[model samples]
Target: MVEAATIGYTSFPGYPEPPYALVYARPDRADTAIGNFLHGLDLADYHVALERMHIGARVSAVFAAERSALVTDFHWVLDD
Candidate 1:
């Protein structure tokens, strides 16, 4: 499975929702491993992996959609 995480984000009244960065990984590697691992999938896959193995980690933008205020920054750890 592929783990897609939103490392960070940015938002404002006149600014687009920045995609930020996503740390990508996979279970196994083989011929065309990258294509098979990353392609022919959707974001929901990440959610599933996150629930099952807690493989994915995300730190959203510090912006509150409702109040348009920046929230506190977020951090995480990965050791496996």
Candidate 2:
């Protein structure tokens, strides 16, 4: 499982800017393994929600089907 942390906005240039959350392989790890791109109708509210998320929260990543293997989805790990 990956530990999630809200890392703020991405550097990619765009109009409706996208925010990001960093995912760590472990809670004690300092380096980020990957960044999850967040999208919403209102970026401001989305960012606020992201900031409120507790650090080290459990999150899951979904990858695209294409060869690029880019992350296409992200969400909190849910119990069955």
Candidate 3:
């Protein structure tokens, strides 16, 4: 499975001028999987995308990928 998200800013304390971010999550990062899918993307691309959205990156975006967790804190919600 895959999940992608992008978020914009708010005026809460400690938040930056325009807090923005983009993230991609997948169950696999193999060479022929999500890793290849995300290949060639870089920091500049992130900055450019944010700029196009007028998000103004006073706070930085986090671009990363890792294996999915075996357990989640919200498991209880699914138990019913």
Candidate 4:
């Protein structure tokens, strides 16, 4: 898994504001299998309030067999 965080005030056209923990997986076909284990978690509640917190968020990816790349899928949720 590759983890990244926003460095500055960044914004996408339809996405949330800065301060996002982006996580994705790029496993070798021989080492890792494809399954729900690759999915991430949802920690928006903690992320918004804490500056240095653990990386946990619900994530999904669209694999491109042609290019062998993981396309990041993002979703926002409010925890109760």
Candidate 5:
């Protein structure tokens, strides 16, 4: 993964923002896998995502694959 600060963002014809910038995936470092993960989750609820991420001692997430990533200290609430 190459590391560089985001110079700018490019958006497509229609979408909230074309996902051109980084909100979490190390904006200073250009990790391809990290970038892809962030982009893939564009439609996810930011508040819920952050809430899930915050239960830890410190918030952290690691993605080996998009379907599941390692998140620290997160608790799950199940629905019946």
Candidate 6:
């Protein structure tokens, strides 16, 4: 499953809520494999991925756990 989250948001004229970002976790969390997969990804990549799914999402930030593979957080926003 995809772990989607957001801390703050901004509303648009025709939108229902605020804008946010997205996180792609793997093996149930944001582990080394997941981090590695997203390591080289840029803002464009993130936007493209979200857009392909028809989501008006923007990645605010990506938090990774360097010491613990079991600890990770993904910040994102959704259109609906």
Best by TM-score: 2
Give all candidates' CA lDDT scores. 0.32, 0.44, 0.31, 0.34, 0.31, 0.35
Worst 10 residues of 6 by lDDT: 33-42
Better of 3 and 6 by lDDT: 6
TM-score of each: 0.21, 0.40, 0.25, 0.27, 0.21, 0.23
Kindly provide the TM-score of model 4 when superposed on the true structure, using C-alpha atoms.
0.27
Candidate 3 differs from the real structure by a C-alpha RMSD in angstroms, to one decimal, of 13.5
Better of 3 and 5 by TM-score: 3
In angstroms, the error of model 6 at 47 is 3.5
Separately for all candidates shown, the number of backbone clashes (residues 3 or more apart, or on different chains) is: 1, 0, 0, 3, 0, 5
Candidate order by lDDT, highest to lowest?
2, 6, 4, 1, 5, 3
- Candidate 2, residues 1-80, lDDT tens digits: the string is 34455555657653224455444433234455555443332335755665544454444444444544334434333111
- Higher lDDT: candidate 3 or 4? 4
TM-score of 3: 0.25
lDDT tens digits by residue: candidate 1, 11-57: 54533344223334443343321111121113345455344323343
Q: Model 6 RMSD to the real structure?
A: 10.7
- Writing each residue's lDDT as its tens digit, candidate 6 over 16-47 gives 33333334433333453222112222234545
lDDT measured at residue 24 in model 6 versus the true structure, 0 to 100:
49
Candidate 6 TM-score, C-alpha based: 0.23
Local accuracy of candidate 3 as per-residue lDDT tens digits, 1-80: 22443444556564334443433333333332121122212224656653433322122222345435432211110000
The TM-score obtained by model 5 is 0.21
Better model by lDDT: candidate 2 vs candidate 3: 2
Full candidate order by TM-score, most accurate first = 2, 4, 3, 6, 1, 5
